[model samples]
Target chain A: MTAVVTGDLPVIEAPRSRRSGGGNGTNFEMYAWIFMRMSGLLLVFLVLGHLFIMLLLDGGVQRINFGFVAGRWASPFWRTWDLAQLWLAQLHGTNGLRVIINDYAERDGTRFWLKMLLYTSSFLVLLLGTLVIFTFDPDITG
Target chain B: MQAPAGTLYRGREGMWSWVAHRVTGVLIFFFLFAHVLDTALVRVSPDSYNRIMDTYKTPLVNLMEVGLVGAVLFHALNGLRVMAIDFWEKGTRYQKQMTWAVLTVFVAVMVPATYRMVAHTFAELFGSTT
Candidate 1:
């Protein structure tokens, strides 16, 4: 190995968690931290129940169809349940991914662009999902 | 005696759990996007929605459903473990044990769930209707 110049060596930085003043003085990170755990707790129930009914009971995946969905959405409680799920899961996951992007994307430009794509996709998903849940017509074809 | 040079987080259960949580979280997020899109098909037409759902009923995809369930369950369990580490006073000290507990619970849930899913798949593939 050749001797390296001291000036050419990259500076070793501590990980984000160890840094005391990593964030921009705003409480955004703190809020993000809180949101993750809270939404995570809620999703444990909402998603598991959804999975159990749609993927495990009444013949599992085979029994699920448009009619199955229609039946579920027929009730206001189920509608509210789905709407809450859509919001919480989408926001929770979006924030989780945002943290990941912040951690991995070292370059400023790369981080900005990655977050743009993430935010865009997540926004569309939230919008589309909310619309579907609210405007779902069981007899659309009829 | 262990050397003090190497990082503690690397090659340890804590790092692995964090890594696993990240990976599964990313994957599940992508799946959620698709799930929303597909569910939106209900507003399109009944026949169109049902036709799209037929793809999910395939045996190959059925196996992936088992894997998805495993990933989801693991993520959920490990999230709780993370919370414990953050909130509980004894959490950091017992994090290794908590990691093991997470795996134990994951396996406990997955075993029976996997068996049930596999059995259902086989019956759907080979069972004859009388």
Candidate 2:
């Protein structure tokens, strides 16, 4: 890449450095990229499976009453499926956001505060989602 | 123009992926809010809830459903991409290739899934005979 030097007289060649680490290396960033592809593949299956069961099977959307949810959750199979989906989706999504925060937030204080906020919100959502799934009371009459 | 100090660009793949992640996250959050409110309507009255759900039975709602599913799939898959970037040392070299690969996988999985969702909704709302 070329850049304009001071005085605006001529274009100057940008310094090219082929060195790997400016003391930080590129290992972490590289690993994050690979994770995106791999997790992406898994998410495709988990998410699609979820949509199919929830939206298409049985009587479709019309049949998805409280009783239906209760029935499904009562089974270990459905519980495990839900648990896996919840954990995978949350971890994947949160980690993705973490990368964005690290890349964009320039100031240390900004980065720290933004990450703290992200972590807090992510934790809250994950906890609430898990709680609702497990402690869902089907019988509202009591 | 005088060149600014430090890195000019952090490359395209990372920036684009970051943008996509934020967009999808916002979409998912909006959908979750609507979903929770709609479901909570059931607490008011079953008849009211059914009426609310009947609104979702429409074609427009079905279209939104496609978008919703797409958002979830894209976010999840791209998230995996972000994770891979964080973990692998060689990931930087393959960032662009992996991004394309993620898009390919997303299309492969999403197109069929969307087709089925639309077809099922059509069948439910208009009947299969139509």
Model number with the top lDDT: 1
Lowest lDDT block of 10, candidate 2 chain B:
B2-11
Model 1, C-alpha of B37: deviation from truth (Å): 0.5
Q: How much lDDT does each candidate structure score? A: 0.87, 0.70
- Residue B33 lDDT, candidate 2, scale 0-100: 42
Which residue runs of candidate 2 sit more than 4 Å off their true CA positions?
Answer: A1-48, A56-63, A76-142, B2-13, B37-52, B123-130
Weakest 10 consecutive residues, lDDT, candidate 2 chain A?
Answer: A3-12
lDDT of 2 by residue, B59-97 (tens): 788788888888887777776676666678976767777
Tens-digit lDDT track of model 1 for A1-142: 2333433444567665466665577788889899999999999999988888777776778888988888888899999999999999999999999999999999999999999999999999999999999898887883
Of the candidates shown, which would achieve the greatest TM-score relative to the real structure? 1
**Model 1: docking quality category:** acceptable
Error of 1 at A18 (Å): 12
